[model samples]
Target: MTLKLAIQSIGVVYGDLGTSPLYVMSGIFPDGIKHEDDILGALSLIFYSIVLIGLIKYVFIVLSANDNGDGGTFALYSLICRYAKASLTPNQQAEDKEVSNYRLEVPSRRLRWASAMKSLLENSKAAKYLLLVVTMLGTAMVIGDGILTPCISVLSAVGGIKKAARSLGDDQIMWISVVILIFLFQVQRFGTHKVGYSFAPILSLWFLNIALIGIYNFVKYDSSVIKAVNPLYIVQYFMKNKKEAWISLGGVILCLTGSEALFADLGHFNILSIRLSSCLVVFPSIILTYFGQAAYLRKHAEDVASTFYSSIPKTVYWPTFVIAVMAAIIASQAMISATFAIVKQSLALGCFPTVKVVHTSRKHEGQIYIPEVNTLLMLACVGVTLGFKTTLKLGNAYGIAVIFVFNVTSTFLVIVMVMIWKTNILLIILYVLTIGLTEFMFLSSVLYKFLEGGYVPLVFTAMMVTIMFIWNYGYRKKYEYELENKVSREALVTIMSNTNIHRVPGVALFYTELVHGISPMFTQYVTNVSSLHSIVVFVSIKSLPISKVPLEERFIFRQVEPEESGLYQCVVRYGYRDAKMERQFFEKVLIDRLKDHIQNDVAPATDKQGEPSDHGIAKVNEESVQKVIGVLDEAIKSGGIMYLMGEREVIASSGSGLAKRFVINCLFNWLKRCVRQQEEVFNIPHKRLLKVGITYEV
Candidate 1:
């Protein structure tokens, strides 16, 4: 991508983070910048906080720890896990398995290991949960932003002409915002492809305008505002009154809420683009604008936040409105895109349940993920807009969740870096201290918004935590059930050979959970005589990335043998992003095998549906057909089993009979309990858990 595209991407994804100044600068002096000292103190807090947290903590320091040239809490976690897992594997395998969770301690610091062990595990989980929740809240903020962006951007732009020369009522702003928002929402269904390219440049120009505005301020103020760069000034303001300054940080720190978005959304934009733009373009603009506002506020305390727009010459109002609209639209889209990214990554990591994902681009597979998420986010945004009524009110409630995640990420990234990579001790220590100080400062600022509007982030965080706990709990519960009952491949084969059962001569499809061991999903109760010469395929399916398997390797199959019952078993696999079952199967080149085993051969080439013109076993060629049956016979006579496994081999079987036990125990119990559950409800045995949201069946 060109620098223009990169800048556009930053303007889009980093918009929320980049445009923190809209509310941030004014937030500091919300009660009006009554004195020169107050204005300068708040300005300095904004400056150094940006330098320490935005520039150093994120752009310079944490961003440097980019894993595989990727950034984001999710990306960092993946790289760190890869790094930590390898080192911990041997130690965990050799040392005590008492510590079920892996620990990240300094290799030589034996003394610190015991003390840090609890902290490491605690921090890792805390960071994971916090990021997950904050990401969700950020997603929610986008919803707030989406509606506001269209409404305010369009309205504010149009609102200027009428308000300046004629009537200045709220109706003009309200009506225009509504009409444009509706138009944008309606066209969203048509998708963004047509104008997406055009939108990119517009977005780049959007940021450039802000950069230019900041440049103008810098040209006017020069280095005079540079004196407002001390941490203690922020401290002294609090020391003087304690109450007012404490609240002031909340507004001041708002400038930096979206700052963390730069890192959280690393997967969307590359490093150089984000770093360069944020420093030279996004950073300076925000700083200069803040200083300009500080200068304006120092000179005009009574007109600080309110009617502050009046301070700018009337000649520039329309341009300001145009820029605001562009920035808002870009910001809104960025948040939506980030929400999409987070969901995709969540599905990949197995932290979220299966959802519909759509790939909109052939150029970049990671370019798109889910439509359902988009629709949901859109709904949330529209709802929040109608509910919150204004962007300023939403801002008061926006940051805590994002900040909570930011601080936690800082803490966890260091631990992750320490565990997974080799870096100088001095740098590591500096990271811990710097990120820590910056995080605490931001958190301190967000507190002021609590009663006024900070409760919004809390609500968002709680919802995220609730969903996270639910997903993780359900996944683990499912895992625990599989762990308790699933059996092994060898045992399955052995059982097939030892039994003298006789029955049908067809394919025996055994439904098993796409999990390790024998899944309890299939029927386990086997008390009657069954057919012989039947190949029992123990099928296991998987969504990729969660398991160790790469998606390309996700669709795997295993063959079962010619046992005493003449049965052959098989298994299948799927990645989360995989296409239809039939398509992926043939694409993987298993057509000949299916033709031979099933004894069916079609025309010269099979169609997309795997349909042969005359569908029967008799269509197979003679020589090739014999080999397929022969292979099956030999497998039956010798091994009596073939193993089916995913990259994770979700179903890990040891011996054949071992699985039979699990089938009999767990699956059977679930069936019986399910039946009883239904019987109690309707006075009849029709319950099967309703099969709601079930990904697979045996």
Candidate 2:
């Protein structure tokens, strides 16, 4: 798992991080600082931002608390919930007596948030399917970015012509960007799996290039530019160039393209590895490169040939171009991959509808590429390239998604930590403030690029947000249409009678939708029918996990021993990563301990015919048990109630709605067959079936 995770991180997750070299430096600092001294200030600002926000805040602070082993929004939600439950104020700290008498098990903040998301999904049909669609859209946009990133970054680097041709008319760089887009589109058929290997090395080279350049710049120029280390400089800059500073943030924000991916991909890779890679490996290099670019611009101000290009030495020109181009491609690749990850994650979260998730590679969940998404990305990116000819312009339009992904992640984080974790109020406030400050700073940096051409990312993000709302809304309405409200428990009980009860001795599968508490209706019916049962299996399909919940955690179930009401149970689970509807509890089983002490397992298929509980067949025989209600009758009185209890089956609303529909449909068909056979049976739909006569006042 660790090895697979490592390869995925290197191959996909770091694409944007590696590509930070393309326009980050060029975008942030002023072109006027083409001299050594003033340029140092710009360099100072860039590096400082990377270190403070990128490394310190995001990697160390936020990524560290991955729940147990899970990372991302949901994982953190779990931890925050843990924290919230454990969270205690200084003034209101619990006393030993209070602790001993009433220990509060705070519900998991993460779980509840996930629950709300799930409820929204289960309650709405469109909401259930929306997860698939929105994610696929994001995936397309990401691929589009991949193509544009390389051409822009590399061409900008080799483009010494402007500074060479006296910083004027040169469409060569623009043309190259277009060509790169063409190449990126061309390679789609072959798939990225083969060419992907070259990406990490090229990205590494790009980073090494910038790191070396930054070092040389610092050594040769006024080292005091290092004073930008003080967060005060950022404050001072904002104070002086308030508006400019605010807008420039949008550009700086670009440096963190796949920041959201960290949370999204938390399930795939270990938190420590990602954190270390970002802080120690990725951050320093980016900061240095930005500063170096600033240094070069400072020293060569009169040479407005192109602040983006003048940063590197004349001798290393072509090599630098090659490296930069590769980095851009890698950046675009990272965007593409992250898009895939995001879409996959959203599908699992139940935000979109009907997305087919194909596990293209058995190696890792991150390796998947949706065909629909790939083609769409090719088109969107091409549009971006034609619309904005230069990398500088692209930078402006690039960060809208980052701003949104970041804010969403941060919002979820605080919700989990402060309210969920129940952490110290002062600390929670401080953390929230920190995230807010970083957001403000990054947002400011990009404004310079907005009018310069920042509308593109927003267009994409808005499209996504709109789709999400639609999918969620449609689903809720659908559920409202099918839901059957229940009357009081007393009224329900009055309808049950021993005369109506028909019992059996095999297995009775009762399906239901368990909201927050136990279902009162199901409870009443079970007790009213004086039934004797060998095994009463309560089956639930808890479609909480998303379709994107990497393959490893995709299908998991936990079975509890039989509890009150003589019911054995099993629940199947999903996270925000798994997609597609599946019948049967992904190969899990429930056990019956009371009677024969025989263990019970539910096969995905039909149970074997004529097989006693003692012989646990590998497969389920769906045909024979169109309806089997088990009973352990030893008397005439309870026997009538028990034998007659075989009248109805039970189930839960946790499985895929599509899957649930299929199961109930199958059950109904079985009941019809029994009636056709002339066997004495009770054939009734759960929603339509009712208690005989008890009525209650509201």
Candidate 3:
């Protein structure tokens, strides 16, 4: 099973990194190779970058920091948040720690600096916000990569048509790429599982083809290109062409483009599987391909722009081209899928707006389709494809997004090493200087091209960061409002006991974000309508940052008042990767759990003779349980399950600054309007749902 997954990971996890060779050489020498030694320098840099960053840092170190089995920036944040009170969401409770997978390791010896760092993060609001901003920036850049990857990968692959038919114009190739991209995204609705069978085979074939061709080129052209593996060439290349070489780091960074996906997609495969696939299959194939490309470039400098295609043997060019295109599609699909996943995670964590998420596969929880996000990606991808007609410009934008994510991951990884892993401070500093310095160099090169197409990701990231910030801000404020104005148990009793407020004969589920208290929305509803349900369940659907909450631990129930009050608090916990339950199934499960809770509560205590100690008391308890059970069953039979949700309009407090007002009144409000309603998210039937409106000034 592990071997199968490792092979399968080749298509999904390594597609982007594998397809990178199609453009890396071309991107590095866009204007064609200036000096033969420059090829050696470029090769050296690529070799070491893969070894240090890709192999050592990510595959070995970063992968070990995964939150349970999940990876990515959010996963890293979750790790830290789990260890400390750094998360902005106040909803996290002591009960959350009881979750089965919410595991933490205590170091044998705690470092003082680690403790101090955790303290600083927990104590400082600014530090927490900064951490969130950094994570969001990484997430936004990944989304940007989702847009730009397809554009560049497909464009680079399709651009190879010029090598075969020189008569074909650039405009023609661009449109062809646009069409392929459109088609690739169009098939996403079918889910990766539908077409996933072919991805592995195609990608595996691609790697094999590239490896064989690389060896052929090395033997036929110049085998001495193997000497480029020496790190000294990197120094000599830099010393000879300092500024140009520095600038070219932007293109060189592209070699590590899809490396982030390795970590991001960790939830789908185990650490051992990923490590095995990347180290054994991906690394060797890619290194060989780059070396072969450098060898070809050393001899035929003019063909640098189309190095991969130009180097291919004449007999198999068309077949390799076909596989390359397919691999490009696979690569694009992986990133697009990853984007949907992260957005879904963001939504679950309340960092993103509640967009409609379609679970595309029942078997694969990770396979999801967001219509809104998919459409936006399609438009952005098409726009980028047309706007950056040349791979060179697209590479500029692509490199920045990839490297920015790398830098963010590096920052987070360092913190994880210190606080979570409790690694030696000296080793952590070494990691910082080595990986950090390398990424900084790459980041600098990419940022240098900010105006030259790099602004694409920066602009997109700013927009995403703004949306995320506004949504999270509003979400936190509304939660705080609920916390402040939660209806007390006494207040709830008073409302229920009111003579004018008649009790309806239905099971009313008042859906709220509050887990422990009666929602203010419920108070507003009862006050205005002068009615209450005989049985009320305040349902708080909580999404945890982990991948999947265990089924046994899904529903948590607490009685708000005495048994006679018929008010219960049910917290339905879900993990980020867990799909939202259907309304009917969810209600059934809740009712079953409620009955189980009642039965457990009223279970009779036996005497030494194995008889009920208090028969009269047991009878009353049994009758009460039967009565509640009958009411619940009747409600289900008569279709009397009503879902009541709060529709809040958030506004800035009058005492706030102008910016706060604009953010709350304008940006946050507009975002709220754009997202799906709570009723819709819960999949409540229109006839069975009632929305209560409330206003809050934050």
Candidate 4:
């Protein structure tokens, strides 16, 4: 984490928080400007919210609850999944334990309560699904954040135009906002890397200007506003305003909207860089800016509607407005990119539909572009902007998503602290009391506005959660069917030994979901055709819980029987972050490994005529088993490789209830169709692919 990297991080990570002062004051005082005491109280709430939630909880605590270097809702889930045996992915091989992030360091003497919690999660199907739903809810809220952050930030910034020219109407402001949003989303295809360097300097200047202006305002308009820093002011605020103060926390929540970005973007920047940037640059600047705005509002209370724009010293208004707009775009960019990353991770873990993920940076796997998601997000952001048409209204919808995700992250962190970190129980209670209570206050406030645009994110969240549920439920049912119905290894070996069945020419790679044993699809194929390939390879591609698998340990090869069977099984494992290899890369690696295995030791030589002799075919050192590698290599070179995959139509069983039938037959089937084809996902060419369709009942 160099000084340069920290500065760059400020550009990317702090955009939302940096731009909050633009709308936070007006949002809190939407009815009208308040008295001097109320302004001080609002300032107090905003300041402490930043200190408590932003700087302390997220920056210091929740950021540490990441898997390896990754953070976010799924990252926390992945960490817990690795520690406990609660992952929905059932095929856990010994090799998977070797991944870098698989931390198996639980206390040898497990606590009874911790062990019970783990057992309940792992043993009960309903508990496990509930956990998945909880995680998906958090992820969906983040997606909601991606939609709302841009609408509020950009609209608020453009609304400043009205401050300059009082004649500008809402329609003109909306058109300007829509144009800016169009431009912002239009450039997404080029990726953030191309324009990343410029972000640091622009954000740095934005912070410096805000801080300088804040200092100027503090001196010019009642430096006494500094007294609002006391916690007693927060008490005074609630006492003075009662229920209104509690409701106003929804507006105060805006200050901490991007606080999670400090943690979620941890993979892009190290903790030290994020921490230093937050403390040295982001935090001080934002607090002073808020205080400055509060001071300006204290005297010119009538200007509370646009304190951020009006209070800007006339000397630098134009530069500040331009910089604020750029900063808002940068903030929206960070949130959008984070949404893509989360969706990609979800796809790898079988929780999302298989959308096309385009790697934007050759050097960074995390830098990606998803056209489907991008277009959807653009449409949603535009809808929110045009529909709400005001920053205050958008702010009402915005805080709910952020607050919900914050509460989810806090709840999961408590479990991690107790079960994984095994922190002192007393300290854990305090965390729940302090952090949990603060978040609940904000959440309650936001939910109070459910009918007033707050329902917007709730609708989005519900839609996303339904998608995830259908996907995961469908995935689990299919896996269970495969596991229960797969042919035993002995039965598969016997089928291979039946010499009466004709052996065809060329190599056949039967793609299976199972890591071991013959897939039901293979049985279906052989039962129908009554024949086998000259060389049959059962290839299973498994996604592990870790982020990346080391290249040397990716594939595990095993012979299906004694040397002459002409059958083998290859298990190729990938971590969630690993790129799907191209067909050429897959074939090259598989063939090289098979060739090495053939040449390594004593094996028999069997000729095309089935005659066993020392010189009959390419030999290792034994008779009757030879030239297998030669056959496979020649077949691959001649484009004679064929891929056999099972296309399953998941249907409702006769005994399934109506709800289950509807979910499986309706929602899951639709989602399955939207997923990428097996051939494309695994980089297998469709020209040489054969599909075997089966109707699977759950």
Candidate 5:
């Protein structure tokens, strides 16, 4: 099973990194190779970058910081939230601690530094906001990668056509690449289970083919290219061509384009499988292929524009070209799938709007397809391809997104070492000096080309960050309103006991985000109609930070006041990766759990007037249990069930500043109107659903 997973991960996890050889050499020397020794210098930089950054920083260190089995920026934030009071949501309760996987490792009291850091984060509002902004920035960059990766990979591979048919124009290659990208995204609805099985064999064969071709080129042209492994060449190359070499770092960084996917897709596969695939298959194949490209460039520098295809032996060029195109599609597919996963995670954590999420595989919870996100990605990718019309410009855009995510991950990793792992301060500083300095240099190089094409990602990221911030700000304010104005138990009792109020013969499920107390929407309903249902259940759906909550621990029940009041509270907990339950299945589970709770916890305590009669306590408990169950069954059979939901309109207060007003009244309201409604999300029937409208000034 482990071996199977390792092989499978190669297709999904390493496709982007593997197919990078198609463009890396060309990107590094877009104008043509100026000096033969420059090839060796660039090769040395690639070798050490893969080793120190990709292999050491991510595969070895960062992968270990995964929250349970989930990875990505949000997962890191969740890990910190669980350890300290870092979450902005105030609905967390003591009952949440009873969950089986809600594990926390508290720092020792003697570790005052760790304690102080946790204290600062928990007590300071500015610190919390800063942390959230950083996380959103990272998430936005990953989405940027999703858009740019497909453009560059497909364009670079399709450019190989010019080597075969010298008469073919650049426009023809662009159209071909666009068509291939469309087809690739069109098939994503089939899910990774089907796509991955087929892709694994293709990617595996691609690696073997490239490695063999690389060895052939290395031996035939110049085996001495192996001498480029020495770090001295990196220094000499820099001294000879300082500014040009620095600018080339933007292109060199493309070698590590898909490195984040190795961590982002961790939830779909295990750590051991990712590590095994990277170390044994991906790492060696990439090194050999790059070395071979360097050797070829040393001899025929004019072929630098189309290095990978130009260097291929004549007899095998067609076969390799076919594989390269397929490999490029596979790489794009991996990034597309990863984008879906991260967006879904963001939605679960309340940072993104609600979109339709389709579970692509019944067996794998992490495999999902969002039609909305897929359509957007497809359009963006095609536009980027046609707009750029060259790999050089797309590479400039891609480098910024990739390196920004790297820097964010590095910042979070240092926090993890200090707070979670308790590593020595000196070792953490050492990590900063080595890995941090390298990424900072890459970031600088990419920023230098901001006007050339790099502004694409920055502009996209700013837009995303703004949307996320506005949504989160409005969400938090609405929750605060609900918490502040919630109807108390005594107030509900008074309303229920009013002489004018009448009991309707149905079961009512009031859906709310509040975990405790009755929603103000309910108060408005009863006050207007002067009636209450025979039985009322306040249903609060909460999403945790983990992947999947255990089935046995999904529902938590509590009585509102007393069993005879016919009011109950149900907190349905789901982890970020868990699928939402369907209407019928969810109703059945809720009713069954409610019945069980009535029999076990509420029956015996119902008769509190005096001691039991000669019939004894068991007899009294049995009678009470039967009576309550009989009432519940009768209500379900005769009156049916209705779902009551709150529809809120949020507006800014009069005293708010211009920025807050814009975020709340304009941007947030527009987003709320655009996203899916509560009734649509839960799939409630129109006849059976009742919506209560309320206005909130935040």
Candidate 6:
């Protein structure tokens, strides 16, 4: 990455880290800082936590665990799934491995544990669900972070209004916050790309402004606060205040809130950019700002609740407040975009409902806008701001979600390091000791505040977990049902050949989840109509785990037996990161491939007497194929074409347990009702689409 991009990355990737100093102190000491030791200890914890977790674990380690270029919880899962063959998606094809990054090599004896882990995941269905839960927990927390980060960051920034004008009330701050938030979310459709360039200048000014303010405060009061850099102060603080010190970890964790975003957004920017911008600009700036806040707090012990504003010089308070709000908005923007990206990944992985995903920038596929999700997020953000009403309460809620997400990311990291990277077991142990222990301390502390605002994220996490689990479970059951009940290829061919069945004139494209044989929906449709189209095509659209499929390998065609019957099956494969093409483009590609198959693979039509019939057809050649395509195009245009899809409702069997029945008959079905039908999901024209309703009890 160029230095320019690295600078730009600071605005996009490090906004949360850049603005963290606004509330980290208050989050650490909600009731105000009383003792000098507490200031030293909190600063010590913040400094070390940033170094250990933010720099070592994420900047250096977890960043490398990205799948192709994409990063996030699901991206890690995607990489592991590729190597282990432990994917839940049933249509995983050998062509998926053709991607450059999906290459596999023989495992050495050192990978025994890795192999065993893969075996455990592959051999157990329970393990898959467990993996899904863990992954979605991280995902859900990210979504929750999308909600909480803005509430706290913007609220804290706007709280400065009270500091500047002590006459202002809480209601005023909140109303301003709500308006800003509404505007923030409302503009997401335009995307960051349009205004992305402006972010760097604002962030740079914000960083420069904070660092200057921090240095001035550090020199003006308690310059010796720099001594907090020693590790001994951390021990002294914990040793002195015991339980209070332990609980304080939840607050201290606020410093590292945006570190996960570094890894989550690895796809959008290069690691070099992330490292350079974070280490050079963001890290030092936040460290200085935190230390400066601690220094000022050590002198004016009552300023903890408003340290950020009070520490600002009178001359620059207005500019500082403006910059703070801008920074907060940028930080919220990063998390919100990350949520959209994660949801898109989940949809591709079949863990989410098929929501409309609009790519905001054609140049960058990752720059997407989900209107439904954005609106929901906006409402939730507004609710959170209205509910918490203060930075401290939101901080309590924020720490839990972020810390637990860190725990999830760390757990997945350990697995990837062991199984994929094949790191030394001893190093892994040290990694777990340092990173895992810190995250656990924070997680435990945050959990202790369960009755306090921490319950909010837990509630959100539970809701998301239920949604993801049901969607995945329901889809898995549907897939298994299809596997069990799909009509056999030979049987389908026999049915097609049966002269008793009436043949209709038209081209019908049957869409199905199943790749090899006819879907049970097709069986039902055929049984009801007791008729077949003149040209029947079975089309299956499959999503691979990779980021992008090669153009040449996007479409695969197979001719069903007795080609004279005009039966064919084709699989159109797209990677999870691939852009969904227009319906017309898809139709053209499918028809062209079908034409190619007919000219090259399928034999010419034959008469009942076993003689080749010309039927006014041209000979087989490159030029003749075009003439043939024109003839076929005329037939397609005149005969008319229809896209056939199934609308399936999964019902619970009579013997199913109460819990299973609720999941299938209630939760899953409710979600199914909410999701768009396949034709709508694929952007197929409604006028040319036919839906076949089918009920399956599993």
Evaluated with TM-score, which candidate comes out highest?
A: 3
Clashing residue pairs, backbone N/CA/C < 3 A, model 6: none
- For model 5, the superposed segments whose C-alpha errors exceed 4 Å read 104-110, 603-615
**Cα error, candidate 6, residue 329 (Å):** 0.9
Per-residue lDDT of 1-698 in model 3, one digit per residue for the tens?
A: 99988988887888899999988987787777788989999999999999999999899999998988999988988788878888887887778779999877768566787899899999999999999999899999999999999999899889888987999988999999999988888888888644654688889999999999988888888899888778999999999999989999998999998999889999888999999999898999999898888888878989888888999999999999999988898889999999998998888878999888888877788889998999999999999988989898889999999999999999999888888788888899999899999999999998999999999999999999999999999999989989999998788777767789887788899889986587789888987888777788999989876778998789988877756777889999998778998778887888889989878876777799989999888788788779878877776666578888887888988899999999899999998888887777677789988889898877
Please name the candidate that would achieve the greatest lDDT relative to the true structure: 3
Determine which window of 10 residues in candidate 4 has minimal summed lDDT.
616-625
Per-residue CA lDDT of model 4 for 1-698, tens digit only, reads 47877888887788888888888888788888556799888998998889889988999998888777778888888777776777776877776786665664666444866777778878988877777889999999999999998888899888887878889999889878888887878878877744655788998999999999999998899899999988898898899889988988899999888998888888777888888999999999999998888888888998888888889998899999999888888888888888988898888778888788777776777677888898899999888888988887888999899999999999889888877877777888998898899999999999999898899999999999999878988888888888888888678777877777888777888888787566788778877788777788889888776666777678777777655777788888876667777687787788777666666544556667866655644443533224565677666665467888888888989999999999999999988887677676666667888888888888
RMSD of model 6 against the true structure: 4.2
Q: Write the per-residue lDDT of candidate 5 for residues 1-698, one digit (tens) a residue.
A: 87888998988888889989988887788778888999999999999999999999999998999988889888888787776677787878787778888885655543665677788888998888888899999999999998998888899888998987989887888999899889988888888534765689999999998998889989999999999889999999999999999999998999998999889888878899999999998889988999999988889999887888988999999999999888888888888888888898888778888788888776777678988899999999999888898898888999999999999999988887777777778888999999999999999999999998999999999999988888888988988888888998789778767889888888999999987677788888887778778888999999886767887789988878745778888999998878988789999999999888888774443346655444566687888888888988988887889888888888888899998899898889999998888888788999998888898887
What lDDT would candidate 6 get against the real structure? 0.84
Q: In what order do the candidates fall by TM-score, top score first? A: 3, 5, 6, 4, 1, 2
Cα-lDDT of candidate 2: 0.50
Winner on TM-score (1 vs 2): 1
Ranking of all candidate structures by their lDDT, best first: 3, 5, 6, 4, 1, 2
Model 2 TM-score (2 dp): 0.63
Q: What is the TM-score of each candidate against the true structure?
A: 0.70, 0.63, 0.98, 0.93, 0.96, 0.94
Candidate 5, overall lDDT? 0.87
| Candidate 6 lowest-lDDT run of ten | 615-624
Error in Å for residue 195 of model 4 = 3.0
lDDT of 4 at 627: 54
lDDT of 3 at 553: 89
lDDT string for model 2 (490-580, tens) is 5433433334545444444444333222233454555565553444444443443222233333322233322223444433344444433
Error of 4 at 92 (Å): 2.2
Total backbone collisions for each predicted model:
32, 104, 0, 6, 0, 0
